[model samples]
Target chain A: MATYPRDLQYTREHEWARIEDDVIRVGITAYAVEQLGDVTLVDMPAPGEDVQAHERFGDIESVKTVSELFAPVSGEVVDVNTDLESSPELVNEGPYEDGWLVTIRPSDQAELDGLMDAAKYEEYLGTLDG
Target chain B: MSEALRETSLTDEHRALGARLVPFAGWRMPVQYEGIKKEHEAVRTRAGLFDVSHMGEILVEGPQAVAAVDRLVTNDVSKLTTGKALYTACCNEQGHILDDLIVYRLEDEKVLVVCNASNRDKIVGHFAQNLSLGTPWNDVSDAWALLALQGPHALATMKDLGAPPSLLELPYFSVTRASLGGVDLWAARTGYTGEDGFEFFCASEDAVALWRALIEAGTCHGLQPVGLGARDTLRLEARLMLYGNDITEETHPLEAGLGWVVKLDAGDFIGRDALRAIKGAGLGRKLVGFEMTGRGIARHGYPIVANGEPVGEVTSGSPGPTVGRNIGLGYVPLALAKVGTTLGIEIRGKVVDAMVVRTPFYKR
Candidate 1:
């Protein structure tokens, strides 16, 4: 299990949500990146697209397999890290930094309460070992 | 219900190397050690060792051995002298592929047929039920282990392992018996990856010593222990046909672009008549190599569209790290199998742009 940033919230799907000003930045966790092998392509919703909490917003493809990118909070896609389109390896290089997928403007700020904190996310990940 | 996975002779070695093991062909096999790209690059650039012990090997002992196997596969095995190997597709009477295999001529009265681990039983059954001769054949999979050392530095690593002084003179697709670390084994200058290499065959009990010796000898040469992950990508780049994906009981060698191995006029064989008929009727659909000219990657089972109509399906696709492009192999109508034909691979409901190109996607 990889250590999650304390301030960010996490989802069972291994996505992370970081509150940046009024928008929530989203990216997959390091644990997910490790499982995906080499990142080849990252597809995400463009700006202004609406995303619902726990819904699939896009896709991430790696050399080994492909995975769905889920929304941690219901909101409109304010921006997508288009840099990932040409250099998807950024995700494997650093899933938290240059690899961040999208930024979403939360429709309901309270929705963040339902997401797991770092400690809670670690606990949730531990259950997956079974 | 799923049965327990089988273990190869070097299961402990893979585990000790911290390889990621997964169930493949009813066996717990290593998928990769560090990563696919890194391991794949290592083999393409330097050298790498692979534990192919899970691959099945069947031996035939009798004067009719080579002749017996020639009738089962598409290649002309009678042309193979002792210490030579040839690749061909084993097909049913209907010309449907059973498996792609390598037949090694060990002696005048002994030959070895190496097939995919998953197709071991089926291939054995095909040979037994189809052959009328008294040539004795045995499934020697459990009794043997295979290791491949591949790349430009492969022969150098072999020399370091004290393989044989004459190994430098070995020709491709040639096999010879030798002893290393007091272990009796036979080696062939053959490999799956498109590179110069050798595949060593030894007893299952001797796999450990051979592995350790090769590793020690390969250390200075930067030989990494590769798993099936890199091996798959490497072979795909080499445009090598993967049995279940590229050629199956549903596909034939002619359509798979393996007609070179089909010696229709050579002699009578299992699917000779059917193959002749197929070759005469002309190909409705044939396999071709393609590259993603646009966004997205093609994968196995993806629908292929041409002129806005679904025309075929992708058989194997991946990022060719060596070629530095997204590449794949798929079946398409004969009219659309030309070198410059444009095709669409329906990936995730969207048809992505692809174009047929020359094959053997990578070469040394």
Candidate 2:
């Protein structure tokens, strides 16, 4: 079983948020990587694009399938992970750390509170398996 | 609740190897073990073992066995002497493909037919419904466990398994009776991957023993247990057609780049007249391989775009692990199917640039 980081917030869509000052970095969780298998490429939202919460920001492609990446918070994308453009397998290797998809300058940081914490997300994942 | 999926004799062995079991055709089979790309790399670099027991096997016997099979497929089966196998396509009366298969001539009056799992029932039913004679044919799928040992080091792995010189020296698309670990079996020098490999047909009861022995003996040769995931990619890179995906009942054999197998002059066969007429009329669209020059991967069902309109459809597409590029096969107007022809694929409603390229993207 994969362990989620306690310091981050998660969404039901399997995205994680890490808030650092005004910037909230976002990426799909380790669970998503495991489900999709090998990560081939990530189509990320460009900087300065306005993203609405619970809506699609970009998409991710695996070897067999492609999936939509949803936004956990309404925000303006401040930066994208260019490293993923060349080495997308890093997402499968470290979804919580170096594989972060995009960093957003949030319009409202309070949205993070509504997302699930480590324990709550683990419970949510259990429901899915059962 | 869904209907229960059937399992092969080696299901337990696959589970023990930590394979992710998924429903394929009517069977629960492994899709992957560790990762698809790694398993694919293993087969390209060394050797990989595949439990292809889900593939349907039929044994046709008696005096008319050879004649019946030759008339059933689009290839010249009569030329196949004992121990020879050839890939062919079975078509319906309308000239549409029923299934792509490998027919092996095991004896003067005995032939073995292997087909796709999804098309097994349909193909078998076609035989029963069409063959007017009371020929002796039996579905011996349950009687055998099929394993495809594929890659560059496949010969070494067979040698490592105590196979005799004749089995080790079997030529391409040929079969021979062989034994390893005291188990008698038939080994065929044929595979879906574009590599030097062999497919072993062993008794169902000896499946576990044979699989275990091969794994144990293949350790030094770097043989990994491959699953359906890598199997599809490896075959796709080699431009091997997947039954339902690449060649379907809606597609014609010639239009799908299977003209070589359509032997019109050989003999009168099912769909031969229709195929001949279709060929004479000339093909409007042709299946061609393409690589993504833009940003998106052209996946199955994606529309091929030209001048803001859909011109064709993608049948099979994926990242070619060996070719290191996003490649796919699709049908387009023959004029637009030439190499270096620029095309666009609509992925998620966005047009992405792509270019037609030669097939078998990864060659040994």
Kept native contacts, as fractions per model, are: 0.64, 0.71
True contacts kept of 1: 0.64
Which lDDT tens digits does candidate 2 get at residues B278-354?
99999999999999999888899999999888999999999989999999999999989999999999999899999
Q: Residues B135-175, candidate 1, lDDT per residue (tens digit)?
A: 89898999999999998888778777676777767899999
In terms of docking quality, how is candidate 2 classified? high
* Runs off by more than 4 Å, candidate 1: none
Considering only N, C-alpha and C atoms within 3 Å, which residue pairs clash in candidate 1? none
lDDT of residue B173 for candidate 1: 96
Off by over 4 Å in 2: none
After best superposition, candidate 1 residue B163: deviation in angstroms? 2.4
DockQ of 2: 0.83
